[model samples]
Structure formats: structure tokens, C-alpha cells
Target: MVNDVLAIHNGNYSWNIAFERGLQDLELDDYALLLTSLHEVHIKVGEDDRSKWKSGRDGIYSVCTYLRSILGSTESSFPWKMTLTVDNLHRKGFYVTEWCYMCKRDGETNDHLFLHCEGVRWLWNTILTSQHMDWVMPRRMEDVLRAWSRKFRDKDSGLVWNLFPGCIVWCVWRERNIRCFEDQAKTTEQIREWFYMTLYT
Candidate 1:
């Protein structure tokens, strides 16, 4: 039944007439947004329809997983902990410059300051190289944590490995605030030292 609306027409995916008429009743912006949302959805031919819980393992849903997904098991981690980056502050009507305090080359966002900034990458690379591992940084902080979780699964060593990312985040945020508010700064090496100290203690 749902496939009827998402039917293939003229060798391309097109909404049926009924769906098109329903879309006409929406406001212009909502209609456009809905179309944009649907544009990438691919329909599989001759397959049974099924539901999936993306947050769960193997597409199997459980209450515990659902709660963790919404609650964010890593809420204390860097991804959700800091929200007052320069860009966010600017968006909230503050007058701070949005440039990153660490690199000063790009706007300060959660991802840029924590993951992709040149100085931050040095910090990450230092840790990764010490572990004899190579990593491609993810676009989002949450994704970084997830990828790290998958890579470091050893029970004995995993605890420290898991703590590495959060420690880096904490150290970077402290350095950022110090520079932003205290007119103090640390070299990338100093930050790396601080990260190791935080991770071990």
C-alpha cells in the first residue's frame, strides 16, 4: 500500500497522483522540505517490507537500546557535554567572534574544534600513533565515539582506550576556554601532556 505512493514511474521514482494531491495541501515550505526528505529514499523491488531500529544491534529493537539512544549513553562525553562554542554563542545573540580559538582558521563548532581543527588533529594523531593505529576522523563527535567503541573492544585495555577521546575533548575545551577568557594559551604539546594526565588520572 505504501509502495503505491512511492511507485516507480517512467523509470524513475515518482509519487502517485493521490500523494501529489495530498502534498499540494501542505504549505510551500513544508511541501518542499517533504519532497527533499523523500528524494533520497530508495525502494527495493520484490522485497518484503520490514522495520528496523537503527540504534540497536542487528536491527533488533530493545527497550534498553531505545532508552540509550534517546538518553545518549555518552552524554558526559564531548559530543553532548559542551554546547557553548563560539558559533553557538554567536547564534545565541552573543557578540563573540566565531573563529576557532585553537586554529583561528575556521568557525568554532563542536565538530571543528573537537575533531577537525589542526591542533586537535595533532592531539588525536599523537594518541593514535602511539597505539599503532590509523584513523580517519569522523564528521561528528558522536560518530567518533561510536567508531572508537567499535575499534577498542578488548576488555582489559578497552577502559583506557575508551577514555581517550573524552579526555582529549576535555583537554581541548579547557584550552579553548583558557585562551578565550583568560588570555592564556598552551602549545599543542602541552595539550597532549594534559590529555595523557587526564586520561591516566
Candidate 2:
């Protein structure tokens, strides 16, 4: 509820003379363009104020934005944060069974849950075959991405190819969570329908 929190007065932003003089003392007068972005934003009365983080595309904050601000973009690809597995939980000090919550056979991992689980294999194979693609499932998530990048060529086909893997991964993770946390289960067909609704809508 502070009016001058951002040094903005009467909804107008201007450099304080003392701060400008300090900047002059620091030999930073050449960086005066930093305050050029402080334009006025109109607030609509009777509307509840909503917080937004401006760094992300949708005006929502993400850890990626915070990391990039600090490290200045190393251009490193980060693993998907949305995918959760029992192994990850175990690593984080949770007492989860060290197996996939979906298949419950092999040890859970990002690679195993998304790529190598038998249930995931069935889901991927069925989806790919419906698209008239007979792809051999890759051993690792990175390999899956590499194979996907090499398989599709045309723009339309490329979009489907790009979104399909992510959709599948998301659906599988959702199903796993439902079974784990909610004690509810969904069949592959239900998952397929959810997948289409997710991407098409």
C-alpha cells in the first residue's frame, strides 16, 4: 500500500534528483536509459488487483525466468519441471516406493516414466500408429527428442510431431498422479481423449 515504493509519485515516474546526483557521482550518467521504461499504467477502478510476473510470455513467473535473470542465459536446456516420478520424490526425501507409480516394475525416472515404462510404451505406440508412424521407442528422453527432430519434415507434420511427445508425457504424468494421489485410474482411451482435448482446445 506504499505510494512511493517504486519511487513513482501520482502514478507518474521520474528520476529523483538526489538519486540522479548519486548516479552522477558513480560515473553512471551514461546509463540514464534504464529509467526510460517507467511509463505510467492506468488502473481500472472496481477491478480487483491481480498480480502478474512480466518476464514470462503469459505474464506469469517461472523458475526459468528467475534463473535467466541471475545467470544471464547459459542457453542450457532444463528438464521439464512438471514431470514427477517416485524416484524424484525419493531423492527429495519422500518415502516413496522406488518404482514407477504407473507400471510399478522398474525404478522410476524421467527417462523411465516418459520413455521406457511398458504402459508408456503402449501409449506412445498406439498414438504413433494412429498417426501412421511406426517409431521404435527410444531409450532416453533426449533420444526421443532427437528422433522426433529427425522424423518430421513439413511444417504441419512438424507441429504434430513436436506437440505429440509433450502431450503424451503430460498425460502419462497426469495419470500417474491420479492413481498415486487421488486413487483414481483412467484407461488408455480416456487418456487419448484427454490428450486430444488438451491439444485441440
Candidate 2 positional error at 3, Å? 12
Best by lDDT: 1
How many residue pairs clash in each candidate at the backbone level?
0, 0
Across 100-201, the per-residue lDDT of candidate 2 in tens digits comes to 777878998998888888877887877778888787777678677766764556787778767878788778878888988898888878877888888676
Worst 10 residues of 2 by lDDT: 37-46
- Each prediction's TM-score versus the true structure: 0.58, 0.60
lDDT of 1 by residue, 1-201 (tens): 666577765556776534434434547788677777777667666677889888988899987677677657654433353378977677668877669989988988888999999968888888889989888888988888777874445775888887888788888989988998999998866877778888887
| Whole-model alpha-carbon lDDT for candidate 2 | 0.70
TM-score of 2: 0.60
Residue-level lDDT for 121 in candidate 1: 88
Clashes of 1: 0
Off by over 4 Å in 1: 1-82, 151-154
Give the candidate number with the greatest TM-score: 2
Q: The CA-based lDDT of model 1 is what? A: 0.78
